[model samples]
Target: MNKELWEKAVAFHGHACPGLALGVRLCEFVQQELGVGVSPDEELVCIAETDSCPVDAVQAILGCTMGKGNLLCSRAGKTAYNFYDRGTGTSIRVVARRNTAELSREERRRQILESPLEDLFSTTEVKYPLPETARIFKTVTCAVCGEGVAEHMARLQDGGIVCPHCFRAYDR
Candidate 1:
């Protein structure tokens, strides 16, 4: 673990929270496992299982960002991440151990920062296919909600585009 890198991650993420520390360590682990440094482009893709403080750390330390189309989020509600090496087609999934869940938020933060990386996370090699449309999408207007949405995300209904929210309303 690089103290300077952790400090930089903390500065970028605003506060020294547990999520941020986990992200910093996860990024470090990914770099070590892949034998590469922070990525500048789509060479690395990160699929975060939740939208949390740690995502900011991932953006800063791993160079994976939503704008760059390399950072993806899922509503799994778990503090896990899957890092894929586009060049080598190698991937790894990392999940925080359940032991940390029993601690208070402050204690969790302290443990994440001070404990060894092996104590905080469980990692495994995984096979995941990268989606072809992950990086490309067209912007379109949702007729039902009058909101703008990605063309790929907008559903076609009655000859017009509808956002997912409006489409769900119709479904119910």
Candidate 2:
């Protein structure tokens, strides 16, 4: 693991923890195993199974971010991540193993950092199709809330265009 990259990830994440270390290691493993580099664009995509600290490491190292629409959250509440390379059509799913042994916080962090990729995660080829690239939808004002929303996200409610936030389910 690169010390500089780890420092940057810790800084970005506000603090250091085992979870963050796992993420840093996971990204490094992907780079080495896949021979891929930082994404300048949406060439790399990460569908993280959790909204945890590790996703932050992935965003910092791989440049797959929510703003760029490359970092997606599956909210499956698992220490798993699915990575896809749009350029090569290669995809991988990495599931980090839980450290069940009783250890102090610092000890746990050190173990995660020092463990080999094969020991830390179960990596496998992704079987599903990769998600479509981010789209640029036109913006339209919601008639109900007078708020601007993506054209595709606008909902037709009571014959009026409304944003999802302002749309209400009608019974009649």
Candidate 3:
């Protein structure tokens, strides 16, 4: 069995690994480890090792965290996909905090190719932005279905409104 592969299959705290990061059993473990005790029936997510240490400082250096989500397409034919840790196998979603968006998707990915994985997240953390906090210009209603405006459903693209569901694109 690949030790590296196994480590990829566990979950760990988003930032500053908890005292009990004994292999990620569930995404909720972050809460449980802190004595929050999660319900076993709750869905769990897999957390891939985000560290790129030389098989030594993987735990101590791993940074940056993201959860699974569908791909989003822009009117400009741009495709934006959310990053997630596939190892955990959980359905939990982690939001991306705008404050921590230090690099463009292309830049961050380019970084992943040039440097050790840990460096990619050196300044970033598991800080995911909750969808609830993400708001559109005037309302949270889907431009197409007029349903609950979700972060994934609504995105700001060059001063325009984009509804990911029906792919609604319009300028303000």
Candidate 4:
């Protein structure tokens, strides 16, 4: 990984750690495999399985961010990330291997950064199609909260449209 990229990841993530290093390595490997660089648009999409320190690295390095709707979190609580390059119609899933050996935080981070790509992560072709690009939906006021929400995300409850945050299910 480039030292400047490492510094950028560290700066974006607030501090350096093993998780962030793993993410950086993953991005580097994916870019090399797909022959792509930081995406200026939605060409590079990432579906991360965990909301961890590494996600910051992905956002910083690959230009995949939640604001752009290219970085989606699956909440699987696993150290896995799926990258899709819309330009090439290529997708890969990279899962970090668990490091069981006890080591200092700095040591673990160094190991992750220095280790060969094959030793640190398992990569496979993604079976699913690329996720759709972000769509702009009309905004409607939530019946309960009176806050504007995308129409597609509004839920119907008690015959009124409410935002997901204000929707409640009947116990029955």
Q: Best candidate, TM-score-wise? A: 2
Candidate 2's C-alpha runs over 4 A off are: 170-172
Lowest lDDT 10-mer window, candidate 1?
126-135
TM-scores for all candidates: the values are 0.81, 0.94, 0.21, 0.93
Q: Model 3 misses residue 12 by how many Å?
A: 10
Off by over 4 Å in 3: 1-63, 67-139, 150-162, 168-172
**What Cα-based lDDT does every candidate model obtain?**
0.80, 0.89, 0.30, 0.88
- Cα displacement (angstroms), candidate 1, residue 28, comes to 1.4
Q: What C-alpha lDDT, on a 0 to 100 scale, does residue 32 get in candidate 1?
A: 76
- Model 4 lDDT per residue over 46-79, tens place: 9988999989988999999998989998889988
Question: Between which residue pairs do clashes occur in model 4?
Answer: none
1-172: candidate 2 lDDT, tens digit per residue: 7999899899999999988999999999888777788998899999998999999999888889998899999898988899998898888898897778999989999998888788998887664468898999999999987989999999998888999999997879
lDDT of 3 by residue, 26-103 (tens): 222233222322222212222232222111112222222222112211222211112233334323322211224587
Q: What is the C-alpha lDDT profile of model 1 across 1-172, one tens digit per residue?
A: 6889889888998888878878887777778777767779878888888899888888998898888888888758988888888889788888877672688888987787778877877887543456343556788999987888988788877888899888855445
- Candidate 2 global CA lDDT score: 0.89
Off by over 4 Å in 4: none
User: How high a TM-score does candidate 4 get?
Assistant: 0.93
Of the candidates shown, which would achieve the greatest lDDT relative to the real structure? 2
Superposition error at 38 for model 2 (Å): 0.7
